[model samples]
Target: MNRTPPSARTGNRRIRWPVVAGLSVVTAVITAVLGHQVPKSPSTSPTSAVPPQAPRGQHRDVPGEADGVVPDGVTVFDDAIPAVANLDPGLLKALRQAAKAAVNDGIEFGVNGGWRSAAYQNQLLRQAVATYGSEEEAARWVATAETSRHVSGDAVDIGRSDATAWLSEHGAGYGLCRIYRNEPWHYELRTDAIDHGCPRMYADPTQDPRMQQ
Candidate 1:
């Protein structure tokens, strides 16, 4: 006689469905919790918002409007070496006014070294270094771009050394002021302008890389 095997006969046996149902419910709860905790997208915050547009008429057709504007009396020195400087348009207007005022007061005012190339500045720096030795030593005698006011094009080396004292007394009326601590010669049209001196490197403004050097 052949005996019936229990394993072979267990094909239709029930799988405890309650245990499987409980596991499914637990998995659903875990998924819901994780979904709530984690952000769906990586870039969703107020701080990551896009920038706003610039106001109308604020942008000018100038090279360094981001830097500053050229004052009224000041003009670009378009020589073989280009000198593009920005002044306070108001200050420049004031310079003309001041020049008129100075004329009334018998003081002669003139502007020199408004905007300079980094090469010209470097040449001056080299001369200073040659005379003094070491940049630190030269800085005591001459201004670096970081300390030079000429980079902004707002600052100018006035005609006379005593111009600072005269400007200090009268510049605010024209929106101009001396920006440097040591360089009595340097003056800027804007009162709020930063006082960093001449840039270390000056690029030729006329050269266009697209035109083939």
Candidate 2:
């Protein structure tokens, strides 16, 4: 048509499409420049997964070196204390030798308890709770982590309760020591005094006050 519509004739002119296109190009260029200036993630390098070897002249801690021996067995408890007769091979040898020495001295140092699994410890805790009403109450009568030497397979309870005193005096000479002060029945071979290919069995020896004796 030669004449414009009434709506278009009276209204102000609209922005041209070319201007909008130009503005879009400008916005895209600005965004690209800003993005280029942004930081990038650090690059990763290939690494070997193998463990490093220990340095030369370094010796690992082993049991029984204080008395010039190695552990002959380790304890693992499957059931009640009396039922625990078996021991770790290394621990068994040491026990046999110590027991022989004790027998010659007219003392009986029988194995009262040995190795124990987490399940066994849990059962013991449950039984204690049942009898004492609460874990805290049971702990007072029983040994807790600070007093537990059972976590290490080397610890054991020997003979009747009275034997604890004798063991305390003579056990270390045989490469054994009462580790926890609170647990009179707990004992472990002197691991720090020995040379093994591993670090000391105990991270903190002082945690067990009996070790000092």
- Taken over the whole model, the C-alpha lDDT of each candidate is 0.54, 0.54
Q: 50-160, model 2: which lDDT tens digit per residue? A: 568989769733322221122333223222232243344455565566767766667666554565554455556677889989876666434443344443455676645
Q: What is the Å distance of residue 173 in model 2 from its true position? A: 1.2
Tell me the spans in candidate 1 whose CA falls farther than 4 Å from its real position: 1-91, 145-147, 192-213
Give model 2's TM-score versus the native structure: 0.44
TM-score of each: 0.45, 0.44
For model 1, residues 76-190, the per-residue Cα lDDT tens digits are 2322223332443554565666666666666656555566544455556778889877866666544555445455445566656455567667766666656445556565565
How many residue pairs clash in all the candidates, one count each? 11, 14
